[model samples]
Target: MPRFSANLGFLWKDIALPDAIRAAKRAGFEAVECHWPYDFSTDSVNQALNDTGLPMVGINTRLGINGIDDLGVCAMPGREAEAKGYIDEAIAYAVAIGCRNINAVAGKTGSTDEAEAVYRRNLAYACAEAAKHDKTIVIEPLSHRAAPGYHLSNVEKGLETIKAVGVANLKLMFDVFHVQVMQGDLIERLRATLPHIGHIQIAAVPDRGEPDQGEVNYPDLLAALDDMGWDGYVGAEYHPRGTMEQGLGWLKAYQ
Candidate 1:
């Protein structure tokens, strides 16, 4: 069976982040992931994970003051220094919390070519920094519809950027929801790109709701992952339909 990690970023929106870690544990999740953990005191969150025995699978790089389009400053020209600072902070936190994956976003802008160049340089630097902590760095492709002007908006671009960086620790954060929205053929694409993927995230397509409510057939999707011999975590990254408890029905089989 595939192991599922609750994405506390969306799963427990109703509680404090420290409390959310407990909630995910009580709800039967063995692991967790968050968009960013910098807002809360790192010590408190680390203690919670220790108490609950839930490994935090991943967290994202910080994107301060920049627009929603500017999530990953690393890819934005003129912000290389700012990006490195965020990377340094993220690496320190990941080491402190015992987490190993960091998702770096590529912010969108006017010139795709320039942004790609900047993204390549920044990702290469990030890969080197992450390797120091034995951490894996991932670049995710956001849906253009959800995030207009985002530079890394599709798997093709994401792959090209990864190649450009040419770092062993650098890989793609294969998000099913975004990929489904941007391009279909999840199985084919997943199979073709499985080796390049470092982590996976899922939710409903068209709507960011629970996997059960979306068009995605998660059972089949997960089964495919199982057959592919994927050993990484499958993050449940979705908004609840009602209470988070109600949204948990789909997870019983996997659990």
Candidate 2:
């Protein structure tokens, strides 16, 4: 069976981060991941994981200040320092939490050419620094509908950035929801990008809801992952249709 990591950022949103970890544990999740757990003390989150014996599969880098909607500034011009610092912070947090993956989002930019240039350079630096700690750095493609001003809106752009970075630690964070929105050939794209993929996330298409609530057949997709030797966590990242527990039937079906 495929290993599914509950994305605590979306799940258990009404509770504290530590309590969410516990909730995931009690819900039968062997591993978990989060968006930004920095609001609370790092030690508190770490203790929750320790108590539950649940591994944090991954965590994302700081998106940016409010109002700007900067999901990640790595691709923005003149924000290289901020981007690097955020990666440092994420790496420290990942180290403290015993997680090995950190996904970075590319912020909006005024210039696409410059953004790609800056993004590649910043990604190379992040990969180098993260590699020192034996950690993986992932860049995900968000759909324009989901993130209107985001820089990398498709897998091709993400892959181009990865190639330009020319580093082994840098990889793609493949999200099924976003990919399905931008492109429809999930299986072919997955196979072609398998070499550059570091981690994966999933949610229902069209509505950004649970996998079972969407048009995608997750059972076959997950089975494809196993057959293709994708030894990474398929992060359950989606908003609950009604309750978080109700959305887990898809995972249970696979198991």
Candidate 3:
């Protein structure tokens, strides 16, 4: 069976981190991922993971002051040094917490080609840092509406940027929600970019809710992944439109 990991960052926002772990465990998840365990200490995170015996499948870099609201790493100009620091910190945290994947945000939009080139250079530097710790940096392509003038808004563009970086540690994170919103033909895209895909995230297409509640037929998607022989985790990275437990009914049916 394909492993299912809950994204605590979105699911259990109201509960404490430890409680979130217990909740996920009770909900029948084998692993969990989060945006950043900012409010909790590394020891706290480790304790929860150890207690539940759930692998920390993935993590994100610090989003600066605003957290998830202002999720951009490559958007800012001349802040490559700052971005590198964040990536380094995330890498250290992931290593300390036994995580193998780290999601990197391609900040906001840039002006000229020269500016975009700088962003790519920064990504390469960050990827090199992550590679040192055996952690892969998955670049997420957000919808153009969410990230205006964003450098990597689609799978093709994201793959192109990864190629430009030319770093082995850099790979693509195919978020089905964002991809569905930004571009259609999900299965075909996944098949075409199978070689470059390093991580996957999913949610309902229009609402970012449960998989069963959305337009995407997840069983078909999962079957496709199985056919492709994908070995990575598919993170549940969506906001629950109702009670978290109610939203997770789809997972129960997976088995």
**Deviation in Å, model 2, residue 236 alpha carbon:** 0.4
Q: Tens digits of per-residue lDDT for model 3 on 97-135?
A: 898888877565553576568668877777788778888
Writing each residue's lDDT as its tens digit, candidate 2 over 1-255 gives 678899998999899999999999988887999988889788999899889999998888888764257777888888888888988899899888889799876787743898888888888888888888999999988888888878887898788888877889989999999999988789889999999998889999888888886688887888888899998788889988898877778776776
| Alpha-carbon shift of residue 6 in model 2 (angstroms) | 0.7
Q: Show where candidate 3 strays beyond 4 Å.
A: 65-70, 110-112
Ranking by lDDT: 2, 1, 3
Q: Which residue pairs show backbone clashes in model 2?
A: none
TM-score per candidate: 0.96, 0.96, 0.93
Question: What CA RMSD would candidate 1 show?
Answer: 1.3
How many clashes show up per model?
1, 0, 4
Cα deviation of 102, candidate 1, in Å = 0.7
lDDT of every model, 2 decimals = 0.86, 0.86, 0.81
